[model samples]
Target: MEIREDDLTGQQIIALLREHLENMHEITPPGSVHALDLERLRSREITFWTAWEGDDLLGCGALKELDPTSGEIKSMRTPAAHRRRGIASKLLEHIIEVARQRGYTHLYLETGAFPAFAPARALYQRYGFEYRGPFGDYADDPNSTFMVKTLVG
Candidate 1:
């Protein structure tokens, strides 16, 4: 699969992101759904990427620079048809490497606390992220699970 920076203008990506938001809303509570919309993801602080296999769009993820030494992972999703194909893992590894390259000392993310999010939580755990209290603008919410990873050189 080819993974590269995306401009978020393609129909496929727009559709995928829409689906991502819809899924988030379906599974997460209204206030606890922290997933960004298309406009938010287009902000200057964020870098988005998509995974592709020829004409097929496999998945997408993004890294958002929170400060000089920290970043947040966002919009990580793989279509149902493409699950368990390592697309999410590849995108995650890519984001982590980019964060390291940018001199970020920590990577943070917030996901749902529901059972529907167990797989996602497991994936982050496998990548060395540990459960943490809320960070950034986040508050303590039972519907949210916050995690952070200390980047070591």
Candidate 2:
């Protein structure tokens, strides 16, 4: 599979992001769902990527610069059909490498606290991300689980 920067214009990517947003809304409470919409993901500080196998999209993820030394992972999603084939894992590893290349010394993310997020939490844990208190604009949120990984930059 190949992972590369995406401009978020293709219909497949748009649909994938829409599905991600929909799942966030479905599983997380209203106020605690922080998934970004298409426009929000286009922020100047964010770099989006899609994972593809030949012509098929396997997954997508993004890295949002929080500061010169820190970044946040966002929009990580593997389509239902692509689950458990290590697509998300590959995308995440790519994002982490990108962060390191950008001179980021730390990477962080926030995911749902529900059982629906168990797999994701496990994935992050396997990659060395440890549970952490909220950072950035986030406050104490019971529905959210924050994680951080110190990069070797």
Candidate 3:
């Protein structure tokens, strides 16, 4: 799979992001959801990427700078046809590598605590992320689980 930077304006990337927003809204309780909006993504706070297999948009994920030593994962999603094919894992690994190359020493993420988010939480755990208290603009919320992974590079 090809992993590359996304400008947030590409039709396929935009549609995939919209899908992520829709899914987050459907699965996460309204008051606890923290997915970024299009405008924020278009800004410099985030670095976004799309994963592709030839012309097929397999998945996408983003890393946002929360500070000099750490970042947050955002907008991770895999197309319906591509789920369970290791696309999200590949995208996530790419994001982690990118963060390390960019000098980030830690990566944090907030995902739903619901059953639908089980696979995602498990994936993060496999990558060595440990549960953590809320950071940045986040607070303790019953609907969200916060996690972090320290980078060795």
Candidate 4:
């Protein structure tokens, strides 16, 4: 699979992202869902990437700079048809590597705490992200599981 940095204009990537957002609305309560839409991603606030295999979109993820030495993982989603093929894993690894090389001292993320998020929780655990209290503007939200990984050299 080839992972490429993409603008929100890429049709395959947009479709894959739209699918993820639509599905999240089903698994998560409306007010608590943090999924991003195409216009939101089109902003200059974050750097996004899409993992692809030829014409097939495998998955996508993004890194949002939180501060000088910190970044947050955003919009991590694997296409339903591409699950269990290591597409999410590859995209995550790529994000972490890029974040570290870019001088980010810590990487953090927020995901659902429901059963629907088990696979994603496991994926983050495998990468050494430990549970943490709410960061950024986040409060003590029972619906959210906050995690962080130190990327210090």
Task: State which candidate has the highest TM-score.
Answer: 1
Clashes of each: 0, 0, 0, 0
Better model by lDDT: candidate 2 vs candidate 3: 2
User: Model 2, stretches more than 4 Å misplaced?
Assistant: none
Q: Per-residue CA lDDT of candidate 3, range 51-87, in tens?
A: 9889889998889999888899998889889999998
Residue 52 alpha-carbon offset, candidate 3, angstroms: 0.8
Quote the positional error of residue 79 for candidate 3 in Å: 1.3
| Local distance difference test values of all predictions, in order | 0.96, 0.94, 0.89, 0.90
TM-scores for the candidates: 0.98, 0.98, 0.95, 0.96
Query: Candidate 3 at residue 29, lDDT?
Result: 75
Across 69-129, the per-residue lDDT of candidate 2 in tens digits comes to 9999999999999999999899999999999889999999999999989999999999999
Task: Tell me the TM-score of model 2.
Answer: 0.98
Top lDDT hit? 1
**Between prediction 2 and prediction 4, which has the larger TM-score?**
2
Ranking by lDDT: 1, 2, 4, 3
lDDT of candidate 3? 0.89
For candidate 4, write residues 1-153 as lDDT tens digits.
998898889778877888888888988886788877888876676999998788888889999889889999999988778899988899999999999988999999999999989999999999999999999988778889999999995
